[model samples]
Target: MELEVKPRIYVVRLGGDNPKLSTALKLVRLGYAVRIHAKEIPPHSVVLNPFSREILKPSDSALLRRYGVVVLDTSWNSGLEDLRSMVGRRRYEQRVLPVLKAGNPINYGVLTKLSSVEAVAAALYITGFKRYSLEILSKFKWGLTFYELNKEYLERYSSTKSAEELIKVQNEILRSMGLQP
Candidate 1:
């Protein structure tokens, strides 16, 4: 059974001066439902956050299909305040993607800090839209690197049915890599 992504994706850019070559902007060029400096957020959508405790799992596909996904576009340096402000603006279901390596030049091989497009693609992949995820990642040269590095983890996360199970698996993966969970 192929799961379809229903809710349109919405991105809110806090204040990072748009870079000349931006992954988020690349996502926009690829015809994704991206909105920069979005003023309003749809209620009940799954908002992607690196800091959120609620792990995004394959089981959340139902919700993604129903309410769509929202991404917070901010720089790692100056976006935290913006994220905090946006959190209270609307009632959104926050979710964090499982452990994954970055393919972006800035944070390649870094854990958990994924580019905006990578985060969106990861969510799409974990939720069973593998093709869509790949299609989105194809826009960047380094995109494939992200997939190659985290393929196993992504596959593992995609196979889990619940957030709890995914979290347990993520913990194990972290431990194996000599990282503290």
Candidate 2:
């Protein structure tokens, strides 16, 4: 394999919603040939990731196959269902889930409240995060953005979080994300 920067373009597909598809398609239209790898997706948007093998249903996969997209259902069996071998789903998961999860305590309403230094709020939430992990998602929520909630979720825990502090963190996170009350 040859070395390259941003070797492939990835699209986020969760069950049935792909908010970034339009953005990605727009990029494609601008002359960027990108490779798409999605998880779950909604109907009507099948035409977006026409070449992805990592899709939701066998039937949908077949339809996408016609468009050149491959379908590999991660639910039919146990164990890690990885698309990296074919398209690289791991990269997308690694890139988006952490931040999104960390920011989960915060919300759309809380986002607006974020202080001038967004990093401070983010750091406050992710502090002591020597390690972390992410939650399994069935679909992508637009509120989380491309990085998910806070990006801090991508690591394993080195220390445990306190219930009180966690509550405070959660509240702060939500407030920062713009979730009022």
What are the lDDT scores of the predictions, listed in order?
0.80, 0.28
lDDT of 2 by residue, 1-181 (tens): 1111221222332223233443334333443324344433323232222124332221222232222221222211221234233333332211100122322223342332221112212222232211111111112233234234444331221122443444344455557767653
Q: lDDT at 46 for candidate 2?
A: 29
Our model 1 lands, by Cα RMSD against the true structure, at: 1.9
lDDT of 1 by residue, 1-181 (tens): 3565544677776657466556776666667867745456666788898767688988788778877788887888777877665444447788878888898998999998888889998998999888888887888888889999999999989999787899899999999999988
TM-score, prediction 1 = 0.90
- What's the CA error at residue 118 for candidate 2, in Å? 16
- Once superposed on the true structure, which residue ranges of model 1 sit more than 4 Å away at CA? 4-7, 36-39, 88-90
Error of 2 at 159 (Å): 19
RMSD of each: 1.9, 15.4
- Tell me each candidate's TM-score: 0.90, 0.22
Residue 74 of model 2, lDDT score: 25
The alpha-carbon lDDT assigned to residue 101 of candidate 2 equals: 35
Name the candidate that leads on lDDT: 1
